[model samples]
Each structure stands twice: as C-alpha cells, then as structure tokens.
Target: MVILSGLMFIGISIGLIAVKYKEAYIGLIENRTDNLQTPSVLME
Candidate 1:
C-alpha cells in the first residue's frame, strides 16, 4: 500500500512537470515569433 501511494505521488509530479515543460516550450516558440507581442498570462 505504501509503495503504491509513493508511485502515485511520483506519477502526479511527473505529469505536472510535463505540463509545465510543454507550456514553457510553447512560450519559447511564441517569443520567437514576430506576430505575437503579448505575453502569456498563464505562465505568469
């Protein structure tokens, strides 16, 4: 039971990290584009 809980916690953390990483990646792409001048409010 303890090991299962620990694995669940780790999985949740990794999911969060993946989401943040994807958002950051999209932000970088937007920053590079000349058409997008507004900043992403979600990141801030």
Candidate 2:
C-alpha cells in the first residue's frame, strides 16, 4: 500500500539522518549514561 511504503521510506530516511549525525546523538546518550553509576542501574 502507498501508506505503508511512505512509512517505510520515512523510517529509512530518519535512520540515515541519525547515522549521519550519529556522533552528536551518541554524545547525548553518553551524557545521559554518565548520570548513572553503571549500566546495571538502567535495568532498575
């Protein structure tokens, strides 16, 4: 269906953009993780 195709295309486009700006995204994630003492804290 056209709607499904459009959704897939948008999803792929967003994924590509994330990959292109992965460093910035990863930096954000790293800052978030820094607040936790360890990765196990995330399981809580």
Global CA lDDT computed for model 2: 0.87
Residue-level lDDT tens digits of model 2 in 1-44: 99999999999999999897998889889987887656766577
RMSD of 1: 7.9
What TM-score quantifies how close candidate 2 is to the native fold?
A: 0.51
Q: With candidate 2 superimposed using the best TM-score fit, by how many Å does residue 38's alpha carbon deviate from the native?
A: 29
Could you tell me how far off, in angstroms, the CA of residue 31 lies in candidate 2 after the best superposition? 17
- Candidate 1 ranges with C-alpha deviation above 4 Å: 35-44
Residues forming the 10-long window of minimal summed lDDT in candidate 2:
35-44
Judge candidate 2 at residue 14 and give its lDDT. 99
The local distance difference test score of each candidate is 0.88, 0.87
The number of clashing residue pairs in model 1 is 0
| Model 2 stretches with alpha carbons more than 4 Å out | 23-44
- After TM-score superposition, the amount by which residue 16's alpha carbon in candidate 1 deviates from its true location, in angstroms, is 0.4
